[model samples]
Target: LRADIYPTLESPSATDWADRMALPVASIMWTPVASVTPDTDIRRVAQVLLDTRLPGLPVVDDNGLLTGFVSRTDILRAVANDPPLDVWG
Candidate 1:
C-alpha cells in the first residue's frame, strides 16, 4: 500500500484539532494518547491506522506530548516507499 493514501483531509489549526475532537471528521484521527507514543512501532501504528479507520495518526509520545505526526505516508517515507505526494497547492 502507498504511504500517503488518505481519502480526505482538511487543513486546520492547532485549536481546531481540539475543537473537532467530538465533531466528525472526514477521516478518523488516532486516539490522542493511544495513537501517539514514542516507542510505538510503526507497524503497530499502521495497524492502528487501519483499525481506527483513519488515514493517519497524530504522533505523540508518552505523557501525552504531541511529538510529531504520522500518516501512512510518513511511515512509508521512512522506508522510501511512499506514495506520490499530494499536490494541493
Candidate 2:
C-alpha cells in the first residue's frame, strides 16, 4: 500500500538543482505579441486573432506602433448572446 510521507524519494543531482535555480522566476510576463492595423475591419481582425490564437491583438498605426488592444473578451462581448466566463486567480 502507498503511504503519505512529508519527505520522500532520492536526492536530486547538483546539476539538476542548478539548472532549476538558473531558470527565470514566475514574475516575468509571458504573452505573445500580436499586431493589427487601424483600418482593418473586425472580420479580418477576427481571422488574425484566430490564426494567432492569442487572447489579445495589439492595434497599431501604419508605422507599427501600439495604439490599442483587442482581446478575446472584447470579441466575445461584441455578440449579443452571452458574456465571457470569469477565470479565478
Global lDDT scores for all candidate models: 0.65, 0.66
C-alpha displacement of 80 in model 2, angstroms?
A: 2.5
lDDT of 1 by residue, 1-89 (tens): 22222335455566755665656644553333446577887789888878876667767666667787788778778655444556573
Q: How many residue pairs clash in each candidate?
A: 2, 0
Instruction: Give stretches of model 2 more than 4 Å off.
Output: 1-33, 81-89
In model 2, the worst 10-residue window by lDDT is: 1-10
lDDT by residue for model 2 (1-89), tens: 01111124256567755765576855333445567777878777788878966667889998878889887777777643344455552
- Pairs of residues at least 3 apart in sequence or in different chains that clash in candidate 1: 3-73, 36-60
lDDT of 1 at 50: 82
Off by over 4 Å in 1: 1-34, 81-89
